[model samples]
Target chain A: MQEVVNFIDLNLIMVGYLFIVGFTGGLVSGFIGSGGAFVLTPGMMSLGVPGTVAVASNMCHKFPKALVGAIKRYKYGQVDIKLGLVMAASASLGVQIGIKIQQIILEKWGQAGSNLYVSLSFVLILVTVGGYVFYDARKSARRTDTAGEMVSNLARRLQRIQLPPMIHFKTADVRISLWLTLPVGFATGMLAATIAVGGFIGVPGMIYVLGASSLIASATELVIAFVMGLGGSINWALHGMVDIRLTLIILAGSLLGVQLGAIGTTYVKEHMIKIVMGTIMLIVAFSRGFAIPQYLAQLKLIEVEENTIRILSAVSFGIMCLALAVGAVIILAAMWKGRFAAEEGAELPDKGSSLEVVSQES
Target chain B: MSGRSYARRKRPYGKVIGFGMLTAALYAAVYLNAPVVMTYFTKGGVYAVLPIATVFLFSYVHGTFAGSLWSLLGIDAKRTRLQERMEKRPAATRKISRPRPRLHA
Candidate 1:
């Protein structure tokens, strides 16, 4: 209904591509509680959106979707809002500081250097943390008696501390000091600013470092996400870079995906959450890792053909999409199976049974 | 049984229509003003309040509508376990202990 802008028309093709991207990304976000943005931003750019517009529009869409997902998950008693909010607030500050740091890098090294830094950070965090998560999940899945309890030693040990301004996250069932919580939120923001998805670190940091359970951590990350996305979107929108059409398109699919993802959370083990995140992260690392050499070539640190670089970039984006796709599949499959089991589990316990107390608690 | 049951419990049609129109209007206003609103919001420093304020506004208007819309559709969560848990709140609670004090790099 609007006049066409550039050659980039908001025709059926653009709309359809964005919808699919949103669906896939939303599916991933719902399960992992964070993602989609990393790929969404780039995906939009491919549709001829300016890099800044893609980021801003993606951010605009992300917060609402996250809010939707968080609320849905909260109903399941998974969200720790206070924790998420506090973390989000501090994370906002971290985003500011992280942006400043990026600006400094941008000034000194220019685009090539900045790109390298972003790429390097992506590889390091995604590979190390993602690999660790995959390993831990595999180990946990080997045991059946434990069922949904993959609480980390770090979280358990951290819960023992008594610091000032201590917050009690009822959902997480752990009370870590505000001092410890600040850094988690801050780092989460910093990394989010750098890598586009705070939950990549926020979720893991909560579990392995701050000691929140996976369910609580993933749910809580949504809070941090809404905060960061709001802050970041403002920054980009200020530049007049947000493409509202793109934002809305992504929102349509993500809203549905996130809702499904949130509901999907109900059917899986806590460790499955870790497994999903870790697997995606590790795969994404490979996705980004493949392009490192080309960036190096750009810096003249290595010699590579332009054709080679172009191929690597395409491959890299392909892998990123694949990673998101795989995550969506795992989450949906797990949720479906979990729901089936839950339905079966729901049977034996009749309305007036003694198990009513347990059902009510749930 | 299904969401069909939840749908039966939704508020009347008039209220739903009113809410929907209001939300659509609110979003229209925000999007139409995005360029200026967003620019001033991200000015940084004291101007940083712009972004934060807009977010709060969006959260309230957009967030509430989204929540209610989902609920009306019978897509609401199964009821919050956190609320029941939060009800057990006490006068004072101790913070979780930290073995290693994390430092920023």
Candidate 2:
């Protein structure tokens, strides 16, 4: 067995950094239904915490934050618990396979090569999916009366397939083959193991493939994240990798953020979820893109100076933070606008009543 | 909103304060005894449950506090009559129909 790494000493500045990131991460996660944890691992690592410990601590914080967020959204009548559980059931298996793949990569190419593979996967997946989601959101935004999510043509087609074991998801209002959910769940779990953000795939899959609304898809993602995070955290804890102090501090901020994020969801339009998720995914793709060059250098596939690699690493981490910050800003702005609109609607006299009075006067 | 009007809204201050205090106390205990907590938590066997248990405890306590704080601030889910109506609509139950066996085909 490998020797465990020592935990980093927490100064006031470090504590503050963790709390702020945790809050924003929680906020984004709550609003989008996928966690803000992708950044936390790197965020903790940047503060001199070991990578394993950072990941373990991040996982430890994730399940609890997700549990909180899921419950809040459930109250809003957005969550589909049955769908989440079904997806999670397959997703847990995907995580195991994903871990096996990672282990194989680590053994074959060592750490640098494994990192390059993860980064490349992040860049490819985030760009393709994020681009599509953002484009769809933009199209939806142009419509005057976008009250509910339109089921994707692909999902509708999939729903017609009557393979034995058709499951009905009531909140999502779709009945699709159980076989169809496996690939999505598996991919979500695999990605989660690889890049630590399965919700990227899970939420989008639920929305587009399974024909769930963005609201339900995102909310249900909390369930998948909670289940997966708990399973992963237990595994890491068994290895003595979780740093309780780090977990607790992050949890402190995330709990509040998650609830606030969940509240923001009820106030906003459905496309806004796609917009936030898409935008973050795109930005995070860039962040991961920046890291690829350094990993290439580490693997000696490209000749680069140590100083340049350091600078690139810093830029990558900065971009990652920017991705999270951008998501948080968009969510906050959308929430504020939604709240203002709601209040104004409340204050204004009924247009129907006014029209009736004018007709009577005439 | 006026304080009196705000009071009429009926925010759960008691739950907020109670959970907040408990969360704070729990945090203080963990941090103040950081060395001991770290040592036992990382023992890598049955001790693994400590971190899991601790986080679950915090989530329940602090999670409630956060939820209450938001409610107290009047930051809440949109309560449109339409949404209420939609929610009140009973959940659809799936009716699976089995094919009857034919005596002769």
Candidate 3:
């Protein structure tokens, strides 16, 4: 490995940009459990940080943020540690395989090919999964019984198989075969390795296949993220790819944002997480979709004007930033509304009671 | 009565300030000694421990500060009736293993 590090000179404007981006990304991660990387990586790259450094620094920051988020959710009785650990065990193995595949592709077809491969995978997975999640959230929203328990048809079917060595998740209120759980963890790891976004698959898989509710799935995904991020960070650090400066600066803002985001989750309903996750996914898919033409041009697979490619790249990054911003707004707004309503309910008197009657009753 | 109740909800000012100061000092140290720290941390070997350990330390310190900061600002999770109900429920029983049939003598 070449030891040449392309560390960017940090100016005031760059610092400010990174801090804001970090806070927004952290907020989203805190709320939904496993995003923020999809934004932070591109955000750093836009500021002239190399792709490897951005990824490594993001991974370095991720474990800590996930740790804090997981702990907070656990306090809320939203995390299933046993299930998270089981899934993480398989996910780590999947990450190793995913990395090996990427290395081979890099060796065979060079940088452009690797970039094209990553971009295509991002577009494909994000579209299919994001589209389904969005549709599910919409359907759930349309239901008259908003407070009713969510049941996944696929999860129900999976649970009926009665495969040997069934595991029960208490926090999630789920019982399913151990073998059935492995694929979700494995796919989460593979996707994390491929596009550096594991939660996209992990959260949905837990909800749809393992019969975990969206709330538990999102919270549990943070545990998987913590484990995966720690391992990935160590691997990247060993390769001398991590920029500690970037990691710390981002952490400074993200720490606060993540706490607020976690608190926000407590205020909102379960479906809100799905809505945020799906919205971010669809927007980011479009962002990556835009960047594909540029990668194709690099590989000489298609002829496109340089200016057009440049514009597309810029628009793609902007859209990515927009996704993070939109997610942050939704989380904060929901939290505020929920808090306000709770406060009002606490203060309001009963319909038949005046202030004097309420006071006497109290 | 409302004022009294509000006042009774004590803010974690001490924790916020203490952790905030400690976090600031750590950041200052890293920034002041950036060259030496960066060089040693990126040496690619047992040096890998440096970055990992540093992040964990920051998470503990800064994470606490952030949590306290929010509490002080009155941004907290509402204790809902549903959550209370869930908390009070008895733990679910785990399925026990059934005995296998014995082989014929």
DockQ metric for all predictions: 0.10, 0.30, 0.29
- Which segments of candidate 2 are over 4 A away from where they belong? A346-362, B1-8, B80-105
- The lDDT ranking, best first, is 2, 3, 1
Winner on DockQ between 1 and 3 is 3
**lDDT (tens digit, per residue) of candidate 2 on A1-362:** 74668998999998999999999999999999875788899889888899989999999999999999998887776788899999999998898999899999999999998999999999999999999999998876664252335668999899999997999976666799999999999999999989999999999999889888777799999999999999989988988999999999899999989999988876676688899999999999998887888889888889988898888888988998999999999999988877776665543122211122122222
How big is the positional error of residue A160 in model 3, measured in Å on the Cα after superposition? Answer: 1.2
Interface RMS deviation of candidate 2 = 6.1
Each candidate's clash count: 8, 0, 0
Give me the candidate number with maximum TM-score: 2
Docking model 1 quality class = incorrect
- Candidate 3: residue A262 Cα off by (Å): 0.8
> Per-residue lDDT tens digits of candidate 3, residues A1-362?
54798787778887788788888888998888877888888788878999889999999999999999988877776788999999999999999999999999999989888888999998999999999999988776665142333568999999998989998887677889999999999999999999988899999999899988777788889999999999889999998888899999999889888888888876775677888999999999989999898878888889999999999988988898898899999999988876775565554221211122112222
- Residue-level lDDT of model 2, residues B1-105, one tens digit each, is 122433357889899999999998999999999999999998877889999999999999999999899889978776533244347877678666989878995
Per-residue lDDT of A355 in model 3: 20
- Please identify model 1 stretches exceeding 4 Å from their true place: A1-7, A147-150, A345-362, B1-105
Candidate 1: tens digits of C-alpha lDDT, residues B5-93: 44457554554466667757865775677666545544445664454455445445554554456556544433323445545556467
TM-score for chain A as predicted in candidate 3: 0.93
- Which residue pairs in candidate 1 have backbone atoms (N, alpha carbon, C) closer than 3 angstroms, thus clashing? A155-A211, A160-B97, A161-B96, A161-B97, A175-B96, A176-B96, A238-B38, A238-B39
Taking the tens digit of each residue's C-alpha lDDT, what string does model 3 give over B27-55? 99998898888888878778899999999
lDDT per residue for candidate 1 within A1-362, as digits (tens), equals 22222323467888888888887787778778898887887887787876766777788888878887887777666788888988888898888898899999999988888888998999998998889888887876664343434457877777788878788876666678888888888989899878888898899888888766677788889888877776667665555555665666677677767877776665565567878899899888899988898878878999999999999999999999998988998987876665554545443212211123223334
